[model samples]
Target: MSRVRHREAVFYDYFRQSTKIIVQAAELFDRIVGEWPSSKPLIPQMKELETRHDELTGSVIDELNRSFITPFDRGDIYSLISLLDGIVDGLEGVSARFDIYGVNEMVQSTRQMSGLILQCAHELDTLFEHFENFKRDGVVLEKVKRVSDLEDEGDLVYRRALGEVFSSSADPVHVLKWKSLLDKTEDALDNCKHVTNVVHSVVMKNA
Candidate 1:
C-alpha cells in the first residue's frame, strides 16, 4: 500500500485502541460504583481493563516501529497514546485503594457518581464511532459535549453527597472511606474529561 494509505491505517488503529482504552476504564469505574457490594471485587475488573490496554499498547507500538510510514508525528502518536493510557492508569490507582483500604460499601452520592461514570463511558464509545465519520458525522462532537455535561452533573452530585456524608456520618473511619471514594469518583470524571479534551484537540488540529 501507499505511504499515505499506511499512515491513515496506523492512525486509525491508534485512535481505535485509544478509544477502547477509554471505554474500558469507564466501564470499570461504572462497575465499581454500580456493582458495589462491600466485597471489593471490582478492583480485579479494573485491573483486567488496564491489562487489556497494556496488551493493545504493545501491539500498537510494535506495529509503529515496523511501519515505514505513519499517519501522524511519532511524538504526537506516542503522546496521544500515553495520554489515553494515563487515564486508565490513574483510574486503576484510585480503584486499588478500595481493596487496600478495605472500603466496602459507599453512599448514595457514590452511586450517583458511578451512574454518571457509566454514562460518560457510553457517550465516549459513541464519540469514537462518530470520530470515524466526524465531517460526515456532526453528531460525534455533540456527544462529546454531552459527556462533558454529565461529568459536570457528576461534580455537583459528588459535592452534595460529601456534604451529606460529613453531616450525617459520625464514625471517623466511615468519613474517611466516603471522602476517599468521593474523591475517586471525581477523579474518574476528570479522566473522562481528559479523553474528551484529547479528542477535541485532535479534531481542532486535523479539522
Candidate 2:
C-alpha cells in the first residue's frame, strides 16, 4: 500500500481496537452485575480494560498529530476516540461503585441495563467492522441505526429502574446509590450511540 493509504489504515485499526476494548469492558460489566459478589473479583479486570482503552486513546491522538493524512475528518476522529474512551470510563466507574458503595445485591434492572449495554457494545463493534467501507457499503448506516435503537431501549430500562429504586427503597441512601449507578450505566449506552453518530456524519460527508 502507498504511504497515504497505510496512514489511513492506521486510524481504522485504532477504531477497531478501541471498539474491541469497549466490548470487553461491557461484557465484564455485564458479568459482574449478573453474578454480584461472586463477580467482584472481575472488577479489577474492568479497570485494566479501562486503562488499556486510555492507552489506545492516547495512541490515536498521537498518531493524529504525527500523520498528515487521516481516514476521516480530524475532528471526527478525535471525537470518536474520545467518545469511545468515555464508554470504558463509564463502565469502570459503575463497576467500581459496586465495591465503593458496598452494594450487597444486584438488582434486576441493573442486570437488564448491563445486558442492554452489552448489546450496544456488540452493535458498535459490528459498526466499526464495516466503517472502513462506509462510502461503498450500506451496512454502516444499518449498524448506526441499531446502536441508536439499543440506546433508546437503555433509556426505557433506566427510567423503569429509577422508578423502582425510588418507590421500592425506603432508605434514602439506597435510592441515591442506585440512581447514581443507573445514570452512569445509561451514560455508557449514550456514549456508544454518540460514536455511531459521529461515524454517520463521516459517512454522509463522504457520500
Best by the lDDT measure? 2
Q: How would you encode candidate 2's per-residue C-alpha lDDT over 113-190 as one tens digit per residue?
A: 899889988988888898889999888899899989988988998899899899998999999998998888899989
TM-score of each: 0.80, 0.98
Among all windows of ten consecutive residues in candidate 1, which has the lowest summed lDDT? 33-42
Candidate 1 per-residue lDDT over residues 16-122, each given as its tens digit: 76677667777767677566665376688778888887777777878777776765456656665665676677678767876677766667777777778777777
Q: For model 2, what is the C-alpha lDDT against the true structure? A: 0.91
Clash pairs, candidate 2, are none
Alpha-carbon error at 59 in model 1, in Å? 4.1
Which portions of model 1 miss their true places by more than 4 Å? 58-79
TM-score of 2: 0.98
Score residue 7 of candidate 1 by CA lDDT: 60
